[model samples]
Target chain A: MNSSASTKERILTAAEALFAQRGFEGASLRQLTAAAGVNLAAVNYHFGSKDHLVEQVFKRRLDQLNARRLGALKHIAGLQETTLEDVLSAFIRPALDLSHDGGGGLFMRVLARAFAEHDDSLRKFLSENYGHVMRQFTVEFARLLPGLSKEELYWRIDLVTGALTHAMSGFGIIQRKSDVSETSHREQTAEHLIRFAAAGLRAP
Target chain B: MNSSASTKERILTAAEALFAQRGFEGASLRQLTAAAGVNLAAVNYHFGSKDHLVEQVFKRRLDQLNARRLGALKHIAGLQETTLEDVLSAFIRPALDLSHDGGGGLFMRVLARAFAEHDDSLRKFLSENYGHVMRQFTVEFARLLPGLSKEELYWRIDLVTGALTHAMSGFGIIQRKSDVSETSHREQTAEHLIRFAAAGLRAP
Candidate 1:
């Protein structure tokens, strides 16, 4: 059991890097297994197939992301003192933490690729499995901002998520300064995102 | 000269679709050439090489996007009656038009992938070539939003672009309904995005 768990960990780690660099089709199973320091049979034994492996890669990170977000939301949900920034922080902080931490930095790139690819199956999987987290957040947002219509609220939330994904992808520009500690940088990032998002959501 | 131009056009069109679907490295020259209904020699002869062709694919659409943005900006630059929405319409309308239109629809996906890749050379190319356009927009946004500090202004602008890219990619959801004509839908999109972005930029 111990060996099997470690082997799965190794494959996932290597797959994230490879998928981030080479994309889904570009990173063949041979290269994936090789990068993981495993063989063809090992990958098959552990994950069944490459398709299954891709789903697992997303599941590993997304489960962490959504769980963190829901946990943060639950702590403050429906509270008398909850502000928009508080809920924004709940949504944004966990994502920012994921991208800056050592292992999951590249996971954002994977998510970005999935977004760009617009793969139908992947979209369905995400909605079916993880859509509830977003729905719960939307409910909280609506409750907080009682004035905005449903369509209007959804539009703002969509743009907010867009900004979140774009920032996490580490796109064309934007970076942390060398003078700051990682934790400090993340704190500032969270502040900036939540502030910007809160203002947008509350916009007339 | 006409034949040559059309050949180049074909290669670019094919390249954009392939790159959007297969990504940069995953789409081979052989496939690109075949899909274009041109010979391998045609690609090398026209674009110089595969890498150069990749740049050309981005350049073609980016040049159009920036030109439209600048043209719109020029019309209203320093005009007395311009509202924030007017300036934003100039900035965003062309992009929404690009995606809703047939051919350039895939270009957003390409842009998303390039952003995801975080490729140093491509990033440099973009900033060097098109940086002036963004700088001009920033100056205008700063003028309109005089209260925001330079650092704060830049941070807000960065997040705004992130959201813009995310929305354009059409990842999973948030699409136009069949009942809404594309033009009306785009108009609404522009309104939604500009309102949200204006508020974010003005965040306290």
Candidate 2:
């Protein structure tokens, strides 16, 4: 974080790195505050609790990521000319782009942890707030693929999400070549993901 | 567990359940022993330490799962008429079938956790021991679809594994209906996964 960044920004930045490394349950507030260069009272004053801080860490990125996705979707949704590939790009690009943001890459690992942790309260929090973004995308997917039953679409969407989470968390067998710049690699990832996801979504 | 089951079997069974619920770091030997209805000495005796026990828990299930996957792949390797979907079924079916085994459902969550954890030592262990299964499958895939480059094949396989891990962990929105029996639900999941994956692997 820049020196000008506030106490709240510093805390969230440190929390994302710690949570990515040590997981939410594993990372203590003392370690978190110490890493942030802030004291315990400052933490309490900024985020209310560790639980609240975790949510803020997620909200900071997800809010922008989802917003970009929805904005992209808004351009293509219900257009007769819109292709499956286009709809997929709207969904996949924003998430992959997050990996390039300064120190924002670890946030993907944090998101992957949320999926694996099976923490009931955290999931409920996600579903209640950001679930609508997915719901909207599914509606658009339904429009383009009229033959698929709602159940089938959900299966595809859920699996596609799995692949995205799995790959975006940097667990894939493929690695970026040293010669390729990060931006170039991100675009290739988007292209590869969009093609595979579009094909999976349109499977007979 | 049955009284006839050995102490090693009992400890392994209980360990898988605890590790599934709480992660490797989160679950303790004491809680694991208490759950298994065995003494602490049994844990030390059966598996030297918590880390070794964790590896054993993985090996017990993964050894079986990979053997089954490779066995299926071997049958179709040089067949004159096997379709891409057939090759995929060989890979996907056995992993999904694990869910139907007694107390085996939670193991998928554990596997999913392993992916998200990003622990270097554990990943190297998986790649060293189990990576060959995927490598063999990839060679078969390459012969069948000569159009895709090696890099492309790896990317799709990685994503498909992600989707498979994501879906099999019961994290998807699609759930078994009340009318669907365990056998029927499992079958449907296999169908959905194989179809989606085959399409994904063969994407243009």
Candidate 3:
């Protein structure tokens, strides 16, 4: 990568860790810059402002994560043979994979912090940029669970999303055994989440 | 109420709002005292320290919440006639009720912040004080869902806890309609959570 790209990458990486550790509001620009080994000017030059930097931090991961989810959903969304489990796996596996990725786990913590902190602008940024991903998945979920009213469907999806976010953020007790490979552990997590969510969504 | 008791109540109420708005670390003692309209010595006199104050904030709500939950669970737990929905309603209804209680809703947001922030001592405090509530519920859950392995049971329970926490914190999109009464809204919420959680727990 070019020097500029590398610097931005470094800032993003350090910012993710600090943000995960000390939240969006708690982590100041000076601390973030010092951690990144970049000066305040570099942060300003690259990301423009702390709020923008926060947005970039989310954008970098979510853009790719949502794309993978959308791609996976497209493969089975409306197909006759598509089971609820298939739809759930498409939605869940990518997030589990991201949680296992280097620094990606930290990002989940940051995302959880975002959920915890009711910063309206950050929320709007997230909804504006990534709302469509959730909307599309909801569409497929609606098609599958035709008996559910729109309100009921939204509630279940929200609950499922919460569960998935919680699990992926490592808030659960199911830590990977030392013997299990990352891939295997992630696969197990996806299986567990998909099974539980499918059943929850399919509730009468 | 006596002067001291009223003062303590004022501090707690203000603390809950500040903590919910700005997290535990972010909300300073000064801000807390100012918000409470009390002096620093008053906080020290009542709670001893900010950490203890934070604990008190949780205790104020969780004590009552857990007591109600355990009371609800006791009525149906281990009964042969107790369905999964019964157990789930036991676990969920109190939390839903809490979200509607005056200043109780803000406490849920504070609880979500607790989940987001990886502060070990606070977690230890919660787990030590309130862990039994979960353990008792798990016992009842295990008795009902004999098909699930111990590990599987924990996973589902964790997911259910996450969903409930997320929803109660008002993170989900399920706002009460203007036509709905507070009691009605809470009832509907409990129903949604109980149904979803019961189905998730009973998953193969």
Candidate 4:
């Protein structure tokens, strides 16, 4: 990466980590600049303001994440008969993959904090930017479960999203000990979640 | 109510509202005291610290809520063959009823924020103090679905909790315009959530 591009990425990485650690209200610009090893002016020059900086951190991951979700959905739609498992995979695999990506786990943590805290501006930004991705899933889900009312479909989708988000945040009550490999645990988690979610979606 | 008892209740009520609005990190002791119409010392006197205060706020409603959940579960267990509907109602009714309770919605919002925003202290507090209630539900859930493995049961329960928490937080994407009556909308939401959750649970 070029010097300027590298600096910008560093700032974002630092900002996301600090924000996830201390939250938007608790994180200071000075701390962010210090962690990024960049001058304070760089943050202003690149992101304009702290609020804008926070927004960028989310958008960086969310934009790509949503695209992957949409792509997965589209691929599933093209199949002759999209079973419940296909639909579940499309909705879930991107999120699970993101969790394993470098720094992607931090991004998921940030997203969870934003959603859980209902930080107003962040929530609005997400709705405006990523709401359509969710809507697309909702439409697909409605089709998958033709018997469900629109209201019922929305409710289940809401739950599914919440569960996925929670799992992504890595805050499950059950934690594996140090002896367990992280990769294996994540794989097991993914399999269990997909199966459990599929059963929920296919329930009569 | 006694003066001290009333004061404690007032602080909790105020804390829940501020916490819901500004989140655990965002809402300060000063803000909490001001909202409660009490002095700073009252907070220290009543709850020892902010972390303790947050735990107390949750404890206040959680005991009653869990009682209701266990009560519902007990009713369901009395039947030889429990339907998906029965299992779902046992799980969801307490949460929905809490949401409908006067000022209960605010508490739900606060609880949602707490889970979304990860502070190690709060997480530890919840796991220590409130984890047993979750375990209680999990035990009942295991009995209902004897066919699933231990890992599978936990995953579904985790998702179910996540979805229910998200719904309670009022982050539902489908916003009802001013044209819809609030009562009608709430009823609609509860009915839809119960049905969706029930269907998902029943799916093989």
Q: List where candidate 4 sits over 4 angstroms from the true fold.
A: A174-187, B75-84, B174-191
Return the top candidate by DockQ: 3
TM-score of 2: 0.94
Residue-by-residue lDDT tens digits, candidate 3, A66-123: 9889999988855769888888988988887787776687888888888988878889
lDDT tens digits, residue span B1-204, model 1: 999999999999999999988788878989988999998899889889888998999999998999989999999976778777778888888888888676998998888888777567888887876799999998889888899888788888899998888777666367899999888988888889999998888888
How well is each residue in B25-101 modelled by candidate 2, as lDDT tens digits?
A: 88888998898888988877767887788888888889888988988888876577888888889988888888768
In the range A1-204, model 1's lDDT, one tens digit per residue, is: 998899999999999999888788778888988988887788889999888899999999999999999999989876769988888888888888888776998998898777776567987887877789999999989989999999899889999988888777766356788998889978877788889999999998
How does chain B score by TM in each prediction?
A: 0.94, 0.93, 0.93, 0.87
Give the worst 10-residue stretch by lDDT in candidate 2 chain B: B1-10
Write the residue-wise lDDT of candidate 4 on A1-204 in tens digits. 499999999999999899888888878999999999999899999888888998999899888798898999999889899877777788777887787777776777788888876667788898898889887877777777898777556666777777778777776675766887988877777766676666566555
Per-candidate interface DockQ score: 0.66, 0.76, 0.78, 0.54
**What would the per-residue lDDT of candidate 4 be over residues B6-73, giving only the tens digit for each residue?**
89999998988888888877889998889888998999988898888989998888877888888888
The TM-score measured for candidate 1 stands at: 0.93
Ranking of all predicted structures according to DockQ, beginning with the best and ending with the worst? 3, 2, 1, 4
Task: Provide TM-scores for the models.
Answer: 0.93, 0.94, 0.95, 0.88
Kindly report, for each predicted structure in the order presented, the TM-score of its chain A compared with the true chain A: 0.94, 0.93, 0.94, 0.91
Q: Supply candidate 3's per-residue lDDT for B13.
A: 94
> Which order, best to worst by lDDT?
3, 2, 1, 4
Arranged by TM-score with the best first, the candidates are: 3, 2, 1, 4
lDDT of 2 by residue, A28-82 (tens): 8999989989887777787788889889999998888888899999887657698
